[model samples]
Target: MFTLGTYQVHFLTFWCFLKVKRKDRWRNGSKKKFQSQVDRETEFLDVQESDQKLNFKLKGPEGEIQQGTCRYLIGAGGAHSAVRKSLGLKFEGGDYNNEFMLGDVHVKSPQRMKGLHAFFTKEGILAFFPFDDSGNFRVIYGDFKNFDAAKKDLTLEELQFKVDQVGPKGIVLSDPSWLSRFRIHHRMAPCFQMGSIFLAGDAAHIHSPIGGQGMNTGIQDALSLCFKIYLNLRRGAPFELLKGYEQERLPIAKDVLRATDLATQFALSNSLSTRMVKKWLLPFLIEHTPLQKKMAETISQLAISRRDQKIRSNLKIQYP
Candidate 1:
């Protein structure tokens, strides 16, 4: 009946934090009742799906392998999802032209790094996001900087050197707490549903960190899918009710990918990238662009499918 596959797939995810944050509106003691249902500090080792149900193999904090099962599976495991691999779905996208570096460290500069700042230098495009008044900030740069650096251990001296490569010169960086080189791109799974199992969050889609929408989108995926699951699983709704999970959420994921793909072009751009970024959004990409943190705004303004007008109810699920 479901179009996903004979073996629909999903990995394990602990929704404790996302759940606790929304527990305020839960009626009565159900929150406490369900609180015990969450598995904290547990990691999934493997999964086996059979006859429209999923069996989980997990490692506990003490390193014991525990087993479990459920009527449904929602894959939220993220980019390297073992669940997705089990489903045999293609991620279907490629990396941007140049490799990138992102790090949060101490920055010293006369320029106010209070908000997102994009600087276009002769070498490439560089941006700064101030983490706090303590001079700690996140720096991002791209433009063929990929080399042995990708292989050798990254060092503070090397990070500063690359910062120099993208020169506007007044800034000094140090106290590197975290630094890593990676490639950004636009990617998505063609299918988000596979029969009794479904995919949500980063397991369903991923894109550039251009507007800080990765986690938000994944949260959206979870909330959207959860309600449908409740309706069918608890409310005794039609077996067909599950079909709407992918129909409703998949298009929204596609919209996010399209929006971020365009934005990533600027993120990875060297020449017109700077000017284009400034042309559309002077200092930041959030307030102006169509990449709305809430899909309600994205649908209304960004021309996402009209079906997406259904406002995302807060994590509150008033199950009937």
Candidate 2:
């Protein structure tokens, strides 16, 4: 991934084929954002609405309960968000049938490990991503068929098997730091705001892991929500300021989900014709300079815009 500036661009990772998350960056940044309120486990139990106030019941690990009332609540809970569930908001998409295995392992590769590499064969698709200067690589094995069987946990030997099957011959996977099997979903909440509670991040939308836009989109939601709330409370702006948060972000989420779905479909293609297209057509398309620049911007999420959108505080915001 990359961040383009006027004169210089920062290469966040060598992987452009797929977007990868750097947990350390998120953890450190979040720590700096909420300096004092760091180690709290907040279990949201219920949200009650009475008169004009919304009361939230939260439970702690020790069974301690607390209640707080606010005019607005922002639900940043991840996928399967309780807040969105309480509001009866359903995600709008289905899970992909294919399953993928991901793991971070110490790998020694003969080929240049600086950039992301995808080995596509009739067997399956296996991609390796080098995260840092170290040889620690994130490997993904895509199984478009045998969904049920592929859902099983990945073993070290199984990782080796997959590597031998699709990855470069000399590359060796060992000393895995993390391993898991998962199925990806593409879903977005119909509406971001209901009453006074607003859904953000995974609570709002989720898509294939291809572009890794999930967390980035959610962080954008938090920033927009916070700024709107700040304006309404501190500057005596109308609550309509918050409506722009949804108007601006929801479409961006939809576009991201669409992009991810397309990329994932191409990556996980199993049919002969699709495989040929992926093998030949895709590389040809990506070779074009203009298309390459556009893909970079789209993958980096620099193309999302809301120039024509207007902020309206009169928009209905439910609190319960």
Candidate 3:
């Protein structure tokens, strides 16, 4: 499922844009069945937001300068977002010491299809995730100390060795497709909005990818923000309605950071506390139906909503 997940995320964010741009031009000079609806313009050079308006300085494909204005700005850019930086938003937290290595390899496993396996060894943490339904797997191993030692390119033989050392007996990995190493970081912009400007995805917050919520969280931000903006524009709602976007999302980002950090710490450490929880507490908790249901909803982001927030959706919004 790793490849499938990766493809879905990419298609949603990037491929969709490319397809829109190339729509009718690709097949022939003839007209297309469906006309592109979005007015996409690229080469954004600078942006400034203030007094309920956004001023953008753009560079065209031919390198000509242009300027435009809008009532709102949404920064979907990844980490190092220029919009967040220009607005002087604070991003708390830094990179953790742990480093993780991942590889896509053909694996022989007796494990059930789509089963996810995680192993905490003295060497660190090892995890196996199905890459697809075709018998390939994504293997990952990492910790703080080994993260530094694992900087260099890891050979296929070395990857197999590491898997053999940490993985369950009888499973073998070979025919590698890709390998890479990365570090975990937990960063959050305390506020998801500043004046008429807003941030989403990695721009608003980023955390350990343990639960696979990184992309999903960003997409959620976009969808939630868009929904609110639609109400403000089409339904004659006040501009202040946009504030709920940040109010709803920032807290979720904080919660995901906390959850992922706890999971990462527990998996990478062999402390007495971790060992006790891993050996006994974890299994017991997993058996609890209510806790499992809660976890399932959280992981799926289905539990995310503003129903509990004191701010009501129909509250009168005063524009600044």
Candidate achieving the largest lDDT: 2
Regions more than 4 Å wrong, model 3: 1-43, 50-52, 59-66, 110-114, 144-146, 153-156, 174-178, 307-320
TM-score of 3: 0.77
lDDT of each: 0.65, 0.74, 0.70
* Rank by lDDT (best first): 2, 3, 1
Pairs in clash, predicted candidate 2: 195-317, 195-318, 195-319, 196-318, 196-319, 239-313, 240-312, 240-313
Q: What is the C-alpha local distance difference test score of candidate 1?
A: 0.65
Worst 10 residues of 3 by lDDT: 1-10
Give me the displacement of residue 274 in model 2, in angstroms: 1.1
Question: What TM-score does candidate 1 get on C-alpha atoms?
Answer: 0.70
Candidate 1 — worst ten consecutive residues by lDDT sum? 3-12
lDDT, candidate 3, 1-320, per-residue tens = 01101001111111111121244476344324436333246555678865667898767667789899988788877888877877788888978787788787778867543555566666666766665556677778885374575357877777778777766656777787678778889999878887778899998998887877887899888877876786677766667778888877888889999999988776777677776676667656766778767777777787876531333335443221
lDDT of 2 at 179: 87
Q: Against the true structure, candidate 2 has what lDDT?
A: 0.74
Query: Local error of candidate 1 at 35, Å?
Result: 2.4
Off by over 4 Å in 2: 1-29, 36-39, 149-152, 306-320
lDDT of 1 by residue, 1-320 (tens): 11110110111111111222234455336647766465778877777877777887889989999999988877777898777878889998777656667777789878655544666554556776666567876787765444343366666777788777664567799877678777776778889888777888888888887656677678666766776777666656566756777887787778778888886775445455555555445434344334333433542333333232332233333533
